[model samples]
Target: MKDASRRVRTEGITGAAVSAVMRDAGLTHGGFYKHFGSKEELLMESLSEAFQEIADRLAQVGEQSKPETAWKAIVKTYLSLEYCDHVEYGCPLPALAPEMARVDKAMKPRIFEELKKYRSRMLPFMPGRRTADKERAFFSIFSTMVGAIEIARMLPEPVMREKVLASARELLLRSF
Candidate 1:
């Protein structure tokens, strides 16, 4: 499942071949069915796992941080150079959301559910006085972070990528 999560984040769904996935998992390609009914099932389940993994990590950060600094910590961590370079271990949004639109229609709801769950998990860490404020902040912060990461991933130079992350980070830090 970890192998599939990394593959889908870095390679996209269609590129995650059963043979390659099985090979990476140190199992025979023919044994794929012993785990998943189909590649779609594997991909969806892996996506869920990816969301859960990142959310849990961020929740831990939120839990450990003071309320006033929680949002800052989460944003800094999200917009850092390390997170920018490591999509395999990063959020599913910037890593896989684009490809998600191209996935089967039936799977869209499941994807949405995972997204909602992720948002809720991270909600407590956002800096806001009210739930409404936090919810609005959620859309702004996450959308900007996702866009920044996606743009940074496209850049060839580390400096340029850092600029993108920094720009978004600064703007968000001030606004939020």
Candidate 2:
């Protein structure tokens, strides 16, 4: 599942071929059936795993930092070049959301559930007092972070990408 999650994050759900996923997992293409019934099933499970990976990461950042600084820390981490360059290990939204938006009806509910779970995990570290305020902050912060990473990933030069990430990081930190 790790390989599948990573593959889908680096290559969109549509682009990550089953044979490549199988090969990366050290299994033959035929072996894929022993796991998932279909590619959509594979994507469903992998996307869940991907959300878990990022949720745990964000939770860890919140746990390890001072409460007042947790929001800033998360923004910084999410907007870092490391996160930008390491798409497979970073948040799933930037890479997956576009394709996810056009996923089949069967997959939409599953994806939405995973997103809600991910949001629940993220809300605690958001920079706001009221529950409503925190909820708003969560959406605003993450949407910007995801957009920043996507744009950074699209740039050709490392310097240009870093500039994008750094600018977003600075602007986001100031919001809190």
Candidate 3:
């Protein structure tokens, strides 16, 4: 059950492929139902795990001497080839945000909580004169980071991928 949870958390639980992967790992399809009360249950747990993984990783970017320096570290990390290549092991914002809109209604609140946690994690490093300014920084940083990664992953050419990511990083770092 722990292995299944770990695998589903890293990957996703929306499709047959996910179940198939579990089957390949020696778990029967019916075994999933015995362990999880419902698909939503599995999804919620997986999302939680993914959210924690990101929170832990981002937390490592500890206090920067300056806001811009911190933002640079963040932007570079989010847009790097390392992050893009390791989708399953890294941030789910880029991988799971699109699916969030289409997830089960019962699971929406859990997903929202994960997003709130993510935004809050970023708030301390942003330079804000007011709450609204801080809010803008939150959205700007998240959008840019996720957008850059998603765009980079879509390009067929490796050079274009690097270019797109680098450009997004530059724009985001300068936005504040």
Candidate 4:
């Protein structure tokens, strides 16, 4: 499952070959169906696992400091070059979102559920006196962070990429 998560995120769900993933996992390509009903099932499960990994990391950040401080740390770590480079093991939201949007109907609900869980994990750290306001803030910050990382990853130059990351991190931190 972990290998699948990494493969799908790094190579993309549609782009990754099932045979290659099976080989990486030390299994025969034919054995894939023994575990997953279909490619969509594998993708949905892999996405769920990736979301859990990210949620765990975010929870740790929230636990390590005050809400605002934790938010800063998360923003810094999330937008860093290391995170951007490590798409396989890092956050799947930025890595898989574009592809997921066009994925099968069966996969969309699973992705949506995982995203809701991810947002719920971050809600406590967001700034808002009301639940609705907090939800709004969380989405705003989360979208900006994800979008910034996605854009940063697209740039061909290292300096430009760093600028985008640093600027986004600065702007987000300042807003909170």
RMSD score of candidate 2 (Å) = 1.4
Residue 174 in model 4: lDDT: 83
> What is the TM-score of each predicted model, taking all chains together?
0.93, 0.93, 0.81, 0.91
lDDT for 45 (candidate 1)? 80
For candidate 2, the TM-score is: 0.93
After superposing candidate 3 on the true structure, give the runs of residues whose Cα lies further than 4 Å from its correct spot.
1-12, 16-35, 64-68
Q: Whole-model Cα lDDT per candidate?
A: 0.87, 0.88, 0.71, 0.82
- Which is the leading candidate under lDDT? 2
Per-residue CA lDDT of model 3 for 1-176, tens digit only, reads 34443466345566526565456445567877786676677666666767777766766663543654765676677788878876776677777777778877878888888888877887776657787897898787888888888888888887889898888887887777
Candidate 1 segments exceeding 4 Å error = 25-27
Worst 10 residues of 4 by lDDT: 21-30
lDDT of 4 at 47: 83
Per-residue lDDT tens digits of candidate 1, residues 124-152? 88889999999999999999999999999
For residue 169, model 1's alpha carbon misses the true position, in angstroms, by: 0.5
How many residue pairs clash in each candidate at the backbone level? 0, 0, 0, 0
What is the per-residue lDDT of model 2 for residues 42-127, given as tens digits with 9 covering 90 to 100?
88888888999989988898889999789888898888888899999988899988899999988899899999999899888988
Tell me which of candidates 1 and 4 scores higher on lDDT.
Answer: 1
Off by over 4 Å in 4: none
